[model samples]
Target: MRVVIVGAGEVGSNIAASLADSHDVVVVDVDPDRVEELNYSLDVLAIHGDGAAIETLEEADAGSADLLIASTDHDETNLATCGTSKVLGDAFTIARVKHVGFLRTWERSSGAFGVDFMVCSNLLTAEDIVQIIGLPAAVDVEWFANGLVQMAEFEIGPESHLVGQTVQEADQFDLLTFAAILRNGDVELPRGDSTLDAGDRIVVIGPPERVYQFATTASPNDAATDTENVFVVGGGEIGFQTARLLQERGIKPRLIEEDPDRAREVAETLSDTLVFQFDATDTEALERENFGAADTVVAALDSDQENLLVSLLAKRLGVNQTIAVVETGEYRDVFEAVGVDVAVNPRVVTAEEITRITREETTEKLTFIEDDRAEVIEVEVDEKSALAGEMIRESIPRLPKGVVVGAIAREQELVSPRGDTVIEVGDHVVLFVDERVAEEVTSSV
Candidate 1:
């Protein structure tokens, strides 16, 4: 597949890095340095020009592209690029935007911008935070098979019950499958003898309820089942969306914005939410609002520095959980070190979504878990596939290490895979794969 990506920024570069080995990836950007960097680092073609221009698309051979992705930071530019690509080529078009209005417009009228699919960075980031808020120990969560199965990553702290236990010993949850473990930047398949250690990140997949229960038990802190109060800083799209999503779940969150106009807009948009027009970073304002009583605080300011400050202040004010939206991936660790519970990177989330859409033709669903160190994928079994008509135990030997079949959907029924369970043709199979052998796992099944 030839994938032409517009804008060689974080999102574009990430998508290119992931797809370069498997497909023909071409990236376009206005900055010569960005193009040069991509050309030097990745095995893909990079074009230096305005991606929305026809000549730039033509130079990248857009007509031959299987998919054209517009991921520039500017919403208008991305929309224009996708629309122009549709007019210039037969490739399927995808646009990344920060505003939700574009998504609503596209949904109301198909082909409005010639965009077959749209990815909203703010909305995606907000949804991710909501998922994290629901699950206690999950740093990241993704769903597959129409939400029937969930894959979550949990960081093992020193106080965790499973810190020193072997994989078999920690197999107390009948519905949960320990997929893989990442320790000190290395990926390891969780075998019966493999012992979990403090600071290790474990990926687990199972029913939503079971996964939530396991996460609560594994977390270092006492996990709360219900969040009574949530304080959201920033009146930007991400913050507003997060508050709106929480409200939809019957959680009325208090939102603070420095700008009165934005605060008024948010108040008008969300009737159930409490809107405060004041500086969220102001210590006096935070104290006046009794912010310490909130169960969770979300920092979604425009600047990473501001978000970091908000998260740190929230922690200082005695908030139980702090979730910050960090635009750049490099700031994630820094934010976490300063006491942020979870740092959500919108760029990484958008890139992962685009990559999944690009691979939708081959896999039913694909989720990058554990900081892209592992993946959970859903695939349909065919007669030609290696696992077709084979028992789970027989096929286990054929698959590469660090891969496990978590569940199977047969004729609208969910089946918990066992050693004796046979994988029949036409059955939908869900598997957790280590990044090192993801390609091998994908090809085999």
Candidate 2:
């Protein structure tokens, strides 16, 4: 498939990189530096021009492209880019916008703004934050196989019970698979003798209940508070949406906003949420509210530095979990490294969501781990699948080396992927694949 992407920023670059290996990709950016960077770094054609302009699309040969993605930071520019692409080709148009109002408008009319699909970054980011809050010890969480299979990444803190345990000793859950151990930014395929470390992030896949059990076992102290008491430190759209989502689930969350006007506005909007106008970085205010005893505290400030400071403060005050919204993808690791439990990047989430649409038929669910260093994908075995009629041991050897068959769902039942287990057609399989071999594994598995 030929794909034309607009705005060569993080989101556009991410989408292009993911699709460049499998499809014809052309990136359009107003910045000459970004276009030049793409030309030298990726296997895609880079054009310098405003993508919302018709002449720019024509120069990029958008008329023959299979898909057109508008991923600029500005909402109107993205919508305009999609509309312009429609005039040039019948390509499926996707627009990435940060406001939920545009998504609501698009949903009301099927092809509003000439966009075939729309992604709301704020809403997506809020959903990501809420999911992390749901799983106490998890830095990331994804569900697959119609919610039967689960994928989670947990950071093993110094207080965790499993910090010093070996993979063999920690293998108490029969239905779970220790997919990969991430230590010091390196992905390690675990052996029975691999020992868990305090700062290591362990990726696991299994049934939802079993994964939840493992999470509790790994961080017993973190899981003790549950999801009852929650605190949100921002009045931005993402924080408001997160509080609203928690309210929907019957959990009233307290929110702190520095700006008095924004705090009043959110207070009026969220009936269940308690909005307080105060600087979250103020140690005295947090203590007065008993924030230390809360089960979870989400730092969603606009500035990355402020969010980092607030997250660390919450951790020092004894908050069970601290999840922060990181605008820049590069700051994610830094935040997590400095004691933030989970760093949610809106751009990364949007890019992954858009890339997901390009490969929807190949996988039921997909999520990028550690900023696209690895991926956990759930795919079904069809008649054309390479591993359809072979045993687990026989088929795995034929695939790429990084592939690990985590679990299988057959007829609504969890099938443990043993060496001798036979993988029949129509069975859904969850696999952890290194990013280097992901494209090959996705095609052949």
Candidate 3:
């Protein structure tokens, strides 16, 4: 596909880097330095100009691009860029915005204005922080199709109950699957005989209700806590959204905004939460709030340096965990080195989201597939489906070609589908078919 990415920042560059391997990618940014860096590092066309300007977009041949992405830090600029690109081409356009008002009011409705999708950085960052805080032991969590299903990661600790267990013998956990393990930095799609040992990072996919139940088994029961008091630094859109999410979850949030006007506006909008006009960088102000008393400290300043510093300071001040919003990949290493517990790139998250919604039929949400030789697929059973009510073993040969039922989801419950397991109506079955026979397998399923 001919893809144009505006911004050339960490998120834009990461998107271009990931997509350039197979697609025609063009990166546009106002910064000549960034453009130069991306042009040499990635096999993508790099152009320097104001992306919000239609003229610059024309120079980059936006009219012919299959998709255009506006991912600059400024919400207005991103919206304008996406709008203008849509006018230049009938291509799908995605904009990265941060304002909650804009997200709630115009995101989906902006299709009339030529935007195919609107990604709110604040919402994405807040969601990431909330999930990470809720499941502190999990490395990552992703929900697909508006939370119909969730994917979670758990690193096998020395005391895990799963150590030395074969793939098939792992606790059923009622409705969750021991999907795949990331061991020694290698992904493995285990089978009945495959054994799991300590230090193996596992990725499990199931409905949220069951996933949370399984998560508790991996960690202590006390891991589930009601984070009632949230301290949010940086009263910008991201900070406000984070505070709003906390409030929605029945948590009382105290937001610290450096700008008095912004703080006043947020305070007026959020009657349920506390808004204070204070510099989060000021140790006196942090101490005044008893920042350590809060369950979580979110460092969401506009500047990456400030976010990193504040997060470090928060950690030093005895906060249980600190989350920082960073804009650059370089800062990821820096943040980790400085002991920041969690970091997120809003642009990268937004880009990944856009790609997911606009992806081709063969595309997968994850870049890393567990089994290179096998393909995992979700095939909904038609009500009148021939395979319905038939035992998997009995239907094995009757299947059109090469499909093998690995797992099945019926009424939001995941079951290890075996030869004796019978498929049912309204079942969303997952098949693990040999790559060579994936098409045949799907045709049969």
Write the residue-wise lDDT of candidate 2 on 129-156 in tens digits: 8877858679899888998888999888
Candidate 3 displacement at residue 23 in angstroms: 4.0
**What's the TM-score of each model vs. the native?**
0.95, 0.96, 0.75
Candidate 1 C-alpha lDDT tens digits along 1-445: 8999999899998898888988889999999998998899999999899999988899999988989999999999999998888877789999999999999999998878879899999999999999888576668888777778888888887888888899998888866888888887787777899998987888888888888888877874757645878899998999999999999999989999999899999999899999999988889989999997778889999999999988888888888778899998998988876678889999999999998898776689998975677788999999888889999999988888777888787887677788899999988888988778887778778
Off by over 4 Å in 1: 411-413
Sorting all predicted structures by lDDT, with the top scorer first, yields 2, 1, 3
Judged by whole-model lDDT over C-alpha atoms, candidate 2 comes out at 0.91
TM-score (C-alpha) between model 2 and the true structure = 0.96
Predicted candidate 3 versus true structure: per-residue lDDT over 84-103, tens digit per residue: 88778887888777776677
Supply the global lDDT for candidate 1. Answer: 0.87
Worst 10 residues of 3 by lDDT: 363-372
- For the record, the alpha-carbon RMSD of candidate 2 to the native fold, in angstroms, is 1.5
lDDT, each prediction: 0.87, 0.91, 0.72
